[model samples]
Target: MSNKKKERKLAKKLLHKYRLVILNEDTFEERFAIKLTRLNVFVLTSISAILLIILTTLLIAFTPLREYIPGYASTSLKRKANELNTKTDSLQKAMLMNERYLASIKSVLTGEVKTEDFNRDSILKAARQDIDFSQVLPNRQDSLLREKVDKEDKYNLFEDNNTANFVLFPPVNGAISEAYNLEEKHYAVDIVVPVDTPVKATADGTVIFAEWTMETGYVMIIEHSQELISVYKHNASLTKTQGDLVKAGEVIAMAGNSGQFSTGPHLHFELWSKGYPVNPTNFIDFE
Candidate 1:
């Protein structure tokens, strides 16, 4: 054979040793082969597996997929969640108590109960009467019983109607910022107005309290008939003093920002009836 043919044969033999076939030697057929070592295949497969695992771990840890994993949240977040649940439970309990009280009142009005024993004091009194402490201690002293009676009397006095009616000194003019909410410690409605705006009473009442407070600032309270009371706070100045009888629509004070808690010049007004605060918005017309 010629030198060229011999060299071609040697090259074809080397290619075959490396798992590569010489194609189209006599026919138009193509051949294919691979020369991968066992170590190379194993390394490639291991790297692919590691990459897949890392990607999966990242997806589960940093994405929303982590929600499927149980107990993944931090302890502080869980504690806050528990606290919110407890508050919700307490609110639900209070709502149920209010509902029951309203139902009891309705039943009494419909002649369900022998008498209207729905008031808080009356209910407590009835409960005390039904209790038999003598059974627990037959030799209970009479002095202790007398002391209990005195305590009950004092409680009754404390529960007496301390409510008063209130009058609007300034009829209308301003915007209300905050509102009265006993739960939030904001026990009055905050009315925002220009400095030195006129403050009026909603009804005729006698001023029971007129002073300055750290929270309320330049406060005034008036007591009226039917145990209704009105409070005006955060005033620039007081036009009246304690025991001063003021009529409705009378200017009792000027609106001002005198206290540290006040954000601007405004009056914080509150209304109480029978020692219980009621929503002032229900009675006053805002203008």
Candidate 2:
């Protein structure tokens, strides 16, 4: 019975009404007045607080202001990060391929390549085996064009060579011990000379490679203009280091029979054009 009486009393206090009034301070006049219950005031304040909280949450979630908060990332920033990751992967793959290519070139320069017994001409001929050469004939227009071109070139003295203005110099003057033979896979000419003979550069270029190896002894490679490259092997000593600029006919090394492949004191010289081995005798007159 006592608990029921206390509950009734609390309800009466919560339902009780109070008058709130505002008056002019000097005139003592009642300007505003309102009758409000305790329950009504509490309900109104609670509703206003809830509405303010919801508005604040919507503003942060639906607008760009969210990105300024901690642990929030912008959309454009994520896209740029993904693009950079893709580019980094591509660059890594390209760098790996370049390293492999450089390793192959190093092996060739060090004389670590294995000789193959196939002829390049034979392979090309085999590829054309199905074609009938007798059936192939030049048409009238083609023949006329060829004749006109020949006539124009017949009297022309200034023929444009693809080597630009570069002239090749003989590295050493000696009897050829071994000529370049495609069938034997010997792409370089071996010039027999006494040990410690001076080996000169063939053209104006920069030394790209200079090192010693077990199979080729002291080897030096130069990169020239016009897509030309010259290689000197079986050298007794190299006078210039890699990245050194050299002139035509400059002494770069001394020839010696210092490698496992050397028969005697000779300079194994090779010339390359556009990455293919070319006959050195075709460019420079050694004798």
Candidate 3:
């Protein structure tokens, strides 16, 4: 027979219906009867297999049961494991440093090391023993040049405007809650004001730092011309970001008590000149 005739005969055989009957042999009565075909059985089997595969895939992808599968790990679990390892490494380093510090302290306590047993003159003489004393003194021209350089540097930072005499704008209009005290090491002035009161900048400058700290809360540092800087701390919120240029008397923050050291709503203001913390009270009046 031809190929087409063979295929047609195969299809007819597969589609040919057969009656399925169930009956009790002794009763001689049929309980059920149904018509079925080879093609129908094949299609039903294929559909069942597809549904089973879909169900298995869903269970493996979404449920924790997937962890039971071999060679499978969640991404989140790996990230957490990495974080734990990093913390452990940091803790190990800290412990090693502490152990070294303890050893040094023990050495000092046992008289194996002396922290303050040497004289200044003897130390200086021992350090200078390798050098000739004649070269220590410069010629007349060199001394003159050295003096000229020192003179120029003496008035470098405060040449145009002495920070000591520079007029500062008040950061906030409020009563002084805490006065500046050198003994207490409180270099900043604390001014009390109503909550949400605007805090102004003391001078025109670019913001060097602006962020929240555990101790100072919302703190901001501004760098002005001539080595002058202003700090505003314990603010409710900051209006400007780091590297922003701010003008004098501009509202930069709001008075608040948002830090660990704060007792009530206030603005903690500080001024610094040439890396030295200056009392804000010296420049601005809070009363």
Best by TM-score: 2
lDDT of 2 by residue, 1-287 (tens): 99999999988888999999999999989999999988999999999999999999999999988989999889988999999999999999999998997796686575354655789998889868978777888899999999999987663322456544668989999999899986676888999888899999999999988988888889999998877789999999999999999999999999998878778899999987766677888777887
Candidate 1 structure quality by residue, lDDT tens digits, 108-154: 22223332336898888887799976775544587788788787564
Instruction: TM-score each candidate.
Output: 0.41, 0.54, 0.45
Global lDDT of each candidate: 0.71, 0.86, 0.80
In model 3, the Cα lDDT at residue 108 comes to 22
Task: Tell me the tens digit of each residue's lDDT in model 3 across 63-102.
Answer: 9989888999878889999999999999999999989855
lDDT for model 2 comes to 0.86
TM-score, ranked from best to worst: 2, 3, 1
The per-candidate count of clashes, in order, stands at 16, 0, 0
Q: How many residue pairs of model 3 clash at the backbone? A: 0
CA displacement after TM-score superposition, residue 20 of candidate 3 (Å)? 64
- The candidate, 2 or 3, that scores higher on lDDT is 2
Judging by lDDT against the true structure, name the best candidate: 2
- Cα RMSD, model 1: 17.2
- Which pairs of residues clash in candidate 3, taking residues 3 or more apart in a chain or in different chains? none
